[model samples]
Target: MPDEPKRIVEAFSQELHAAYHKAGVRSYEAFAARSTKINRAMHSDTGKHTFVSRSAAYKTLTGKRERLPTWDQVAQFVRVFRAEAADRGIAPDSVGTMEQWKAKYEAASARFWAAKKAAASRIPAMAAAVPAAFSDGPQTWWRAYADVVPAWSERYLNHEPLSHRITSYEPVYVPGLLQTPEYAAAVIRLGHGDEPEERIARRVELRMLRQRHLERVGERPCMWAIINEGALRDGPVGGETMRAQIRHLRSLGRHVQVQVIPAGHPAHDATDGPITLLRFPSSQFQDLVFLEHADSALYPSSEEDLAHYLHAVQKLGLAALMPDPSRTLLRRLEAEI
Candidate 1:
């Protein structure tokens, strides 16, 4: 009878955890609330013990008396829970086994997480304990890339307003931020294929937003894109669009530098793939190298890795026209087109 109850308790615990995970509820309070609601579906709210109670808590995540999915059904629903919890600073390990609960009636983890949040809010004065940017120490091997971008942007955006440089080699088309509306729309339609109208709108809208990084007028990314003479002739988006794009690239030199790798050159290495390298004011770190494929993108921030990209850029730039001559070439293209 004891083992039967234990087997039943295990099923309930798994069900309770499953509901928490399925609801996309990462915090304890959210999990507890979801568990309680589902528990009530099978029986009245048994409160903390509702999950363990043999009479309550449905086998399904929704707390529905029927439609209780098997354990296999639960896996797919909770797929995002583990990663989602890690992001929100919750641990899967904290949710213990049910046998421990029978030994000592600890409060439901979901409820406990909620209670802590409420308690923290009550003492507003103490809530300012953590600084805007929390760092483990002066140095750490692992810093999230998401944190690096904002912090680096904030520090370098102004001080090195002149020094921040981006030398890009785009093989496919104009870089997203520099692209014209017509070209952007053309590219999106080709890529999305049968994507819904809303999806197409979002892709265009996101590109337009990226354009603002350059459109800020005063302090902006000094983007220097080098295209093969072939790029000048390729014209995937077609002539009228290419004319606008090439002319736009030419016009940008008035505000920011533009360079064209002369088309007549026999062959070159930079044309092999597109590589974007960005420099920062802080000498503590080397320049950042961003590599982009069709759908995926990566920013390499480490010094050794960045140095390799920088050397490649140096060698590549040697093969391209200087800023002034590059501008002159762009002007000539405008006149010819």
Candidate 2:
């Protein structure tokens, strides 16, 4: 990873730090303590147990652990499972050195299943429990994230369709979250002339870490970032690298949404400068907006602002090609070689 600070980490990290605030934790320690619960779950519940320790695990995994659920979460989970285990008197290990504990649980479960199969005369019983409801629509999902975004990050090891959709307009350069490593490092060195070597490395790592949201859990929402025609033609990373990056954007359009609004076209709301829009697909309206300037970024969520951004997106969709045409344009651009 390059040593430049990546916007992805900065964005998620800030959201996490704020989550601790609602949990009634204002201090850094309190925030970090609650935050680590996310890392803990990755190791145990999701089965990424190769992670043996946590002292510096934060550094290695972008603070995402291959850890297990906390006792509180596990306890609640067990209650739901216990009824299924039923009169068979099935019990799960509550204490463990981890490796030994896993083996014991598996062995016991296997024996329980075999014994049940042998005793056909035993009283018939319902075995499966009601599955948990994970709502599919936007409001349910966004509320779940907004109520406790960081906490959700802990429990959910996969992608999340956030409370809002972030759309950025770029006239100057590619957004850092989408930049290639070599281009990013060049940009960072240009911006942070005196940043230490170690600092740069950490920043690059953090940036790469943030990109996971794009395809990690198969749930990250679509992105619609309109580029200025000049940005496409200038080859900011030099002809070859910029061409590669442009091709990358074209490829993304296959999966998400991306369009280029020619510079000569009539200016629209996004013309003043680059801005980001994050909208939610809630059955209800819980839409949000984020705008960034040279030195500051703000989330504007009042209904008035939300409506403005949504309207902007509606216009963008109108101006941009449908997915198929967008792919064709990209292929044409790539063929130009």
TM-score of each: 0.48, 0.46
Clashes of each: 1, 20
lDDT of 1 by residue, 1-337 (tens): 1233334335545655664654356455454355444534533331111121112222233332211222212332243344345555767434333344323222332333344334433433211332323211332321223232233232222222223566777645677767887778777776576878766666676567555656666666667676655455443455567678877776674445555666544333223347876554445434545555333333444445567777766666777788788767766665554
User: For this target, which candidate reaches the highest lDDT against the unseen true structure?
Assistant: 1
Candidate 1 positional error at 43, Å: 70
> What pairs collide in candidate 1?
28-110
Question: Mind giving the per-residue lDDT tens digits that candidate 2 earns over 1-337?
Answer: 1111233333333432332232233343332343345434643454221111222212212423212222222232233223223323544322223355344434433443344234422422211111123222233423433432233132121222342355666645666557777666655554454978766665556555546556645556666676655455533344456667767776563335677654344432233345666444553534434444332333444456567767766675666555566567666655653
Query: How accurate locally is residue 84 in candidate 2, as Cα lDDT from 0 to 100?
Result: 26
Instruction: Give the residue spans of candidate 2 off by over 4 A.
Output: 1-166, 268-270, 281-285, 331-337
Q: What RMSD, rounded to one decimal, does every model reach?
A: 21.5, 22.7
Highest TM-score against the true fold, candidate: 1
TM-score of candidate 2 on Cα atoms, chains taken together: 0.46
Q: Looking at candidate 2, what is the lDDT of residue 122?
A: 40
